[model samples]
Target: MNRMQLAALATVATLFTACGSSSDTGPQPVAIDFKALVGTQTFSCADTAGYAIGTGTLPWIPKDFRFYVSNVRLVDAAGVEAPVTLDASVWQGYGVALLDFENGTGNCTGGTVETNKSIQGTVAPGSYVGLKFDVGVPTASNHLNVQAANPPLANSAMYWSWTTGYKFMKIDGLINRATPFTFNFHLGSTGCTLATPGDFTTASCTTLNVPSASFAAFNPTTQAVALDLALLFAATNFDTADGGGAPGCMSGATDPECAPIFPKLGLPFGTTPAGSQASFRLVTK
Candidate 1:
């Protein structure tokens, strides 16, 4: 080839390199989506028709839905896990992001109006086919310091107290009754011991209660994480509060209500062995 023609080809290559035709520019941005559902119905504060729940199939009004997800990792085609470099926001930071499904409208009146249905971040350019994540906030910022933590961590509605720590996940609904009481599922790290009972925060919790999930064929671009409330309440009796501290499961070790609830999360509680997690499933959008 002529020298002039070779020089022209080299210039074209440089332009392509500058435009980042491949992964040389850096990682790509990814937004893993999530949604709340009771069976096939997409859950929302605007739903006036309550969903049939529990064994009786009583209509249960969606009240509140929110949870913290941590240690998010994207899985490659070869089954290798890569940690997500999360984007910082009011709902995301510090290797954790709070997924809020409620908008404080209709029956979901107690929480904030803002909703975060996706985990925004960056991932290496590759053929990622799966996802892995934990169901709670990480230990470093999860131990009773909402006052000092970052945005999503600083959200007070999620935190309970200095002794108990943050309520890792909360999914509540108004159930059938003479009064139509609310059934609250406040799952968090229990069996805690404080360093100083009166002053210091919790030193450690015997039951971390951080259940995790991994889906082998998930696609962040075309699929979303669906948290199903119907299957979660399959064994729970909304009409009766049995062997429990509250009207619903409160993550207490002795609470029989929690025993049934934990297995739905693919976790073992008391005599109830771990079952496949029924609540979280990846669905095609």
Candidate 2:
């Protein structure tokens, strides 16, 4: 091979290497900030500072509630949804696993006060289309043996031993009328009858599964997701003058309160009304 021909071949080889390198670089991933905004409402009598709701002092009334959301799924640009399951074994330093409301508490059996709590996670850059998750604890995990329950479950405060289940929703606050008062809006499974006298025995009770709701359209880069407590009890049936109270709704059934309040707050049901159906939207930058 002549010197000139050898040089030309070397140049061609270098150019091919550069082209291959560029092709292998692929697309860069962007950083995405994801958050879960959670809040609750209160059914209180009227006095001055609107209806008391959430964590506050000297208002109409405060109804404080917490939710434990896990096993979150994120949708990507390719129209593919990815599941982001977190370590549900603990919550905020407390030991409490995920709670399945459907199957009762027997499946896993024990938990902590912090069990089934909601937390936020970081998402990578992608065009998220929608989100999906279960609302209540599934039946398999719901009906666990309370005697063998862990810390939070062993606490007994959250458990309804008499009824052989747990309360899915605890809506409590002070109610005011011509005066001031309190209202307890606790909903869960009732009419429970045990099949056998055992630690994790099945109960004759059943829970209702409410469908999830879609709250908003979100783009992680351009928007933010937040849960507005004000919208939760906007239609609450409470009046100070008349001692008004919110209409009761069964937890596992198509309760009136669950339908009106949840949907207004951005949660909708698809087929089954047990869990919530909604995607987190980017509300702020």
Query: Which structure among the candidates has the greatest TM-score?
Result: 1
> Which ranges of candidate 2 are over 4 A from the true structure?
1-60, 92-129, 151-157, 187-200, 210-225, 240-282
Which prediction has the highest lDDT against the true structure?
Answer: 1
How high is the CA lDDT of each candidate model?
Answer: 0.77, 0.40
Off by over 4 Å in 1: 1-22, 162-164, 196-202
Estimate, for each residue in 238-283, the C-alpha lDDT of model 1 and write its tens digit: 7674555767777878877787679989888997777668789988
- Give the per-residue lDDT digits (tens) of candidate 2, residues 131-182: 5443343444446776676633443545655666655444444455556644
Using all chains and alpha carbons, the TM-scores for the candidates as numbered come to 0.87, 0.52
True-vs-predicted CA distance for residue 8, candidate 2, Å = 35
Q: Predicted candidate 1: what Cα RMSD to the true structure?
A: 5.9
Q: Clashes per prediction? A: 0, 48
